[model samples]
Target: MFSHRVAALRPSPIREILGLVDRPGMVSFAGGLPATDTLPHPRVDLDPTTLQYGPSEGDPALRAVVSENLRGLGIDAPPERVLILSGSQQGIDLVAKLFVDPGTPVAVENPTYLAALQTFRFHGAAFTDLDWTDTPAAPLTYVVPTFANPTGRCATTAERDALARACTDGGVTLFEDDPYRELAYGPCDRTPIAARMRGGSWIYQGSFSKTFAPGLRLGFLAASDDLFPRLVMLKQAVDLHSSSLSQKIVLDAITAGTWPGRLTDLAAFYRRRRDTFDAALHRHFDGHATWSPPDGGLFFWLRLDRPVDTRTLLPEAITRNVAFMPGEEFYAGEPRLGTLRLNFSHADADATERGLRTLADLLTEQ
Candidate 1:
């Protein structure tokens, strides 16, 4: 028979809503997928012949590119330490499978990534949250730190210091999941918590899905040497290796000097869109809504001042042809009824303003 944990995990809420917004003309801010138009053209000329099995670690060129990027982040990731993943999502599962045992204590942000929670839950890890004041024990803690999902809260430099101290003191390992690190649009100043701590104590996972193209499904993890080999073996058992083809393509793209230019352009582009959405949210739904401007990231967490539960509001909003993620889906146990997340990446300038207007009008009438 199959494992019980396999049956216990729920499908990701965002994944479930993906198809719903696929109707011919619907505007989507649901998926965390990056804007495809921003990715650089593939530079690696695929031979169509070398499309076979890749190295268990990753492609040499890709590894080199990743290693260079890691150095920029202050992590001394050798090529051997990098294991290319299908995406950062798969890296989450691999970590969970290797580090999380059934009933083992795992720490997570109060409002964390739904998929990471699902991955750990499927691996049968028991989760405890890092709350506003609660200090956890020697557990494995998971955090987004920068532009946290559904909260738009970037961990402050002070919070980063405190988190590092907690992890070091509690003898806990920190999983820094930073997919939206490069999308900063506002005043952002915080170093990675992992960078602040001792080596091997913090496991950092990053993805090209947000910065580059998601279909490439490219992600890399930087950890201490102790954790790298086991994750590589776990990855080898799972998917053997992330596609060599994708790796080469990304490598070529990065080395060609397009990735950096595109990154700056992408950040500026998203920043404008974010500012527009923030203004629209204020102009249309100012008093009744509450949200912090996301300094860098795709989604903005919004809390409605009234009793209008997002779960309750979704059906009506959908009928009226507007939709957003309910805040509760990001929670571990009970969903936050009045909270919701609005993704500003997918929508263009006009669509963003229009979508926010529709939601605001609906709320005003309600």
Candidate 2:
């Protein structure tokens, strides 16, 4: 029999959606995956020796690139502070294992990343969604500060200040998941919460998946000196090390000075998709839909003018050759009706346009 922790967690909604959207003619934007087409110069020729089992921590070159990138975020940490993971989701699991014991009260964004929820739940952490009725009296809090998954909302400077101040005052462990930080379509105004953190209690997780390619499974964790070793141990237990081959690929790519240009090009590409989809939603649904224009990232969190039951509508939409994961799965508490997260990244311009029209028609009929 499985452990109680395993029994308590629900299967990830993204995994369930993966199975349902396998049919032809379905345009599914449920997962936070990059469009494979946007991946810059996929294959790299490397010495066969690099493919062998590497160090338990990541390769040195990869660590340097990761450390250099973190410096751009205002985190002044050496390569020792960086621990590479198979992906950022692995970073989430590491955080849960290192810090959370059973019944540890961990505060999360109201609608947080569902996969992160699954990872934390599997580790037996008790999750409480932050209700901003008044400022929260800290405790351990996890938030996606920029281009948040499911909501596609970036925190304002005031919001970031308030959160950092609250956490500092309350003596909370702050974990910031910042995978989409580089995908900003517009100007960025706020400083990172980790940068503003006073006592170095904050932990920041970032990924090259969206900026580079997810297949590489490259991501790193930047944490306070206090939490670093525990996270390293967790990584050691999980897979011994992240892939040395892929890390080298990333190292070469970043060193070549092409990564920044690639990210800039991706920003332009996704911005067009965001604009086109937003315009199409207005043309088709008129005043029947509302959504925040994402300053960056692959998703737009949309709310219908009329209350729509996504639970019922999802299956119906799939039958009509359309598919999207429902919004209910993102919330830790009661599901938000009339809300949906749509991705504008994976599909091409033509496919994205068609998918929106089909989705709008399906939702209207419901």
Candidate 3:
């Protein structure tokens, strides 16, 4: 028999959709996967120790690299404050394990990252809606402020400041999940909420999965003095340490000074995909549906003009050799029938166009 938590859990909708998208000739806009061709394959001269067991806290060199990256985001994080995780997803799990108790109040964006909602649910976290402009009085709140997954909406500077101030004054722990911060389109503001907060009221999670390669399974968590030690201990209990070889490779690649240029190229590549997807949406469904052009990130969250349930339409889309994420899966509360998320990063321009057109035709027929 499974535990109650395990029993309550549902399979990830995105993961389930991935299976459907793998069919022959399927044009998938389902997963938020980085373009495989854009992934970095740097040749690093590995130290002998890289193959051995690493420190539970993570590789010191990699932590330092992560610290510097945080500094670029205006967060004054030291290497000692960072804890490496197998992925940002693991970081979420650890946070939920440490902070959330059964029925503990947790605030999240209305349509937050689906996996995060799942993780919090495992720890029995009671979800509340988060408004960036006004902070709710919950013990912990999670946000993907910049180019949020599924929705791809970025918060304004004032909103970031307000969130930071709320956490500082209210003693709420602001969980800033920022995998797509660097994937912005142009001169968008990306001031981290941690920068505006005083004291230990925020935890920031970043991943190389978006910037480098997800297969590496590398991500870092920067916590305030109060929470860093507990997270380190939790990580140690979860997995003695993350992969040593992966950390070494990431460290060498970032230190080689080529990573920044790669990120630039990545942005340009995704921008073109975003444009292509947007054009298709406008051309096919401009009057039939409503959606915002994301400033950056991989997805476009569209709301159908008519009352069409996306969950019921997914199998039909797959039958048409196209796939996307129905938006009902992203919400922490009630499901939204008309909404769905389309990923533009993994699919190339032609594939994206074909997929969107197929989806549009399906909607038209409906």
lDDT of 3 by residue, 1-366 (tens): 888788787788788888876688889889988887887767878778889998988998889888987887788699999888899999999999989998999999989899999999988999999977676768999999999988999888888888888788878898999999888886668888887787856899989998889989999989899898999899888899999988988888888767789888889888888888889889888977899889988899999897677989998888889988889888999877799998888887778778888998899888
Residue lDDT tens for model 2, 1-366? 877776666767687777765578778877776877787775778899788888776887778778887877687567888888898988888888876788777888878898888877777677887743334533578899888888888888878877777776777878899998888888765367888877747788888898888888888888888878888887888899999888887888888767678778888888988898777777766666788788998898888887776778887777776667778778877877888888878777777777778888887666
lDDT of 1 by residue, 26-60 (tens): 66667775655665566466687559876888887
Stretches off by above 4 angstroms in model 1 are 131-135
Candidates, ranked, lDDT: 3, 2, 1
The models' CA-based lDDT, in order, is 0.79, 0.79, 0.87
Candidates arranged by TM-score, highest first: 3, 2, 1
Clashes of 3: 0
How much is 3 displaced in model 1, in angstroms?
A: 2.2
The local distance difference test score of model 3 is: 0.87
User: lDDT score, residue 170, model 3?
Assistant: 79
Give the 10-residue window scoring lowest on summed lDDT in candidate 3. 129-138
Write the number of the candidate with greater lDDT, choosing between 2 and 3: 3
Question: Mind sharing the TM-score for model 2?
Answer: 0.94
